[model samples]
Target chain A: MLELQDISVIFHPGTIHEKVALSHINFRIEEGDFITIIGSNGAGKSTLFQTISGAIAPYQGHIFLHQQDITSLKEHKRSRFIGRLFQDPLKGTAPSMTIAENLALAGCQGHYFSLKPILAKQRQQMYEALKELNLGLEERMDTKVGVLSGGQRQALSLLMATYAKPQLLLLDEHTAALDPQTASKVLELTDKIVKKNQMTTLMITHNMQDALTYGQKIMIMKEGQIIDVINSERKKDLTVEQLIHLYSSKTNDYNDRILL
Target chain B: MLNQVVVIGALELGSIFAIMSLGLYISYKVLNLPDLTVDGSFTLGCAVSAVMTLSGHPVIGLILAFISGLLAGVVTGVLTTKLKIASLLAGILTMTGLYSVNLKIMNDSPHISLFDCSTVFTPLSVFGEYGVLLFIGVVVIVVTLCLHYFLKTQFGLALRACGDNEDMVKASSIDVDIMKMIGLSLANGLVSLSGAIYAQHQAFSDSQSGTGMMVIGLASIIIGMAFIKKDQMAYQLLAVIVGSIIYRGILTIALQIGIPSTDLKLLSAILVVVALILTKVKMRRKEVC
Candidate 1:
């Protein structure tokens, strides 16, 4: 389980450009919880995820993963237990490196690096993993990742994120850049991988349908706070229309553009 | 006879400089760090080697030269990574500081002559004219093979990743600072070794010998890249060595064609500019295609 106690992230605390990105966000995530986060732009959703990943330090808070205080851990150190996929397809992978090399790097996550060669056995394992996606990436193990399409790259990113079997997985709008069909395919793959590993996943998505279609729990964020969290039982019975009705009533903002 | 002499001399010098170019390849191309410390480290290598050889320990001289270069690189790496100084500025600062350091190493002398000293090449004296060539050729080959294998390892992949995408590297749980330090240290160490070898070959080490070394190394790398398919890492390194030889050939031919010695630096500057422009034009054409 992960816990955040009085997490507050303030950018430029005293200057004129001072902005409260996250204000005293207190939340807890149980083990094996698949939570999908939905919010408008600048609603502190990304900030919340960043705070948890140690990319951004909270002004006043303590974060714990399995009762181990990770509030002051550096990003690279925290990466041992945390896997992340960025929204930009280019962000998660090294373009100039080959597919097999990237997978090799992923496999060595949280481990000491040696001068040993990437063995054939390791490459074979990676090929099998890529074959599961059915993307034909297994045939192009030596090809540079720069030449891959956005969807293919994101698929590889997802595989790399889950390859090391971290304690938590964070996907920040990972499929937002792909076309609708590709996005759905990636989403399906995400569900398959998460369920297979029984990973504790927190996915941020703008699509209300996706927010509803996947994940066991749904948390709505607004103005740097978790305003509403719909649990599994109620979430199963809820529809997109009812969710929208609740959102409109809670914020009193009837703009469809804001929710979408 | 004159042409043959020019060609042989060029080959000898080219093989020596090829080592330095390989060092630049690591810092500039692999780490993507613009390290100006190369100039100072080159001189430091010469100075240390020359003094050690003068003290009757030629082999120890070469080893010390490499160690000194590594120390210099570590200073630059610390300045850039830990202190957050701009990489270029950090290199420049180290280069400037090394001026005095090199002078001190030579006992405040601007140059040292090893005319009667026993160098690594001395054992091969029976071969006469081909001795230096054979010695340098073997060194370059061993260095190339070692580097080729090193770059294929896991540490090498992480080092390359640091240059390609730092965020991805950090996300993968590799320490970026340590990688940078290791890269810089390795680069400068190779550069100094080249300098040490050159001093032993020429039987002299001048403090000013490394003034335009960075330009020469860069020009060699650029020239080599132009002649080879650069998609593969091994081929790219080989191309850099070939480029160094070709660059030396061109320089020797220019000198033979009656170019004054004083204008050599100007020619080096112009050559770098042309090489850079050629690379840019090729990239633009690729984009258009």
Candidate 2:
């Protein structure tokens, strides 16, 4: 479980160019809670994820993971218990390194790196995991990730993120760059992986259908604030059209293009 | 007879510089950092080794030289990582600072001569001119093998990841700053080792000896990579060593053909320019393919 209290992020504070990115945002995530966050651009969705991952320090807030204060933890230190996937597949994996090497790196969470070999067992595990994606990555374990297609790279990125089973998984529009079919495939895998691990996940997506279809909870955001959070009971029966009506009614600044 | 001497001398010096090129490979190629500190640390190594050897501690001299190189790298790493200075600027700052430190280490002298001092090569003196060659060859092999093995380790993989994609490394819970510090230290340490041995081999350590050393190392790396299959980590390292030798051979040939010794630095710059241009062309061709 993770919690953020009174979180605020201001860019270039006290200057004419100053803008509040996140403001007094409070959020709590329960164990095994799969949260799908929907927001238009500048809604502070990425900032919230960055704050949780310790990439950006909140100007005024406290972050807690499992009842432990983690606001001051460095980004790399926070990553031990937090797995993150970025919108750009290239950002999530090392392109110059092989798939096996990337998996080996992910598997090293919470463990000291030693001089010992990465082990054949670790490679075997990576191969099996890649084989599950049905992307033929198992046959090219030694191939540099740079040569892989975007969908294949994102799939491998997903595998790397969850390989260690971190306490919290953060996906920031991870499938946005893929084509429709590939995006759906990745989303399906995301759903399967989350269910299999019972992972506490926070995913941000612009796709209204994806928002309505996945996760036990759905939260809508506007202007650095969470306007509404529909729980599993309400979320099970919620329609995209109704969600859009509720959003437009609340914000009064409807952007129909976001529904796509 | 003169050609044979030139060839042998080139090989001897080339092997010594191969160690330095390997160090540069770690910083420039592996870590993706252009560390100019090598320009000073190489001389610092020679200064420390020369001063220590003159005082009858050849082994201690080498160890101290390596340690000093590590400290120099730490300074650069801290400046770049903690102070958030640009890596190139940090290297320049450290290199400038090391100038005075090198002078101080040499007791205010610009140069030290170990001509009469016993060195690591003294025990192999019975092999005559081959002593220096043998000593340098063994050292290069040991350093290369150790580096090859180290790069294959988990820690080494993390270090490589730090260079290739720092965000991915951070996401994996590996501290990018610490990895950079460790890598810089190891790289500069090897460069210093090269300087230390060079001081003993040449029987002199001048503060200016390390001038243009970075370009030389870069040239060697670029040339070596062009000749070798770079897909494997081990082969890439071997390429650096071989590149150093070939670089030296080219310089030797230039000298044999009546090129002035004073123009050697110009030659080094030209070599780097050509190597870089060739690399760009190759990359462009690959893209076209």
lDDT of 2 by residue, A114-224 (tens): 887689988888888888888788999999999999999999999999999999999999999999999999999999999999999999998888988889998988899
Off by over 4 Å in 2: none
Deviation from native of the Cα of residue B271 in model 2, angstroms? 1.0
Clashing pairs in 2: none
DockQ class, candidate 2: medium
Specify the poorest-scoring 10-residue window by lDDT in model 2 chain A. A251-260
How well does each candidate reproduce the native contacts, as fnat? 0.79, 0.88
**TM-scores of chain A across candidates:** 0.97, 0.97
Candidate 2 lDDT over B1-289, as tens digits, reads: 3566677789999999999999998899889999999999999999999999999999899999989999899999999999999999999999999999999999999988888789988899799877778878988999999999988788888889889998788777998898899999999999998999889888899989889999999999999999996678888988999999999999988888899999999999999999999899999999999
Q: In terms of docking quality, how is candidate 1 classified?
A: medium
Model 2 / residue B54 / CA error / Å: 0.7
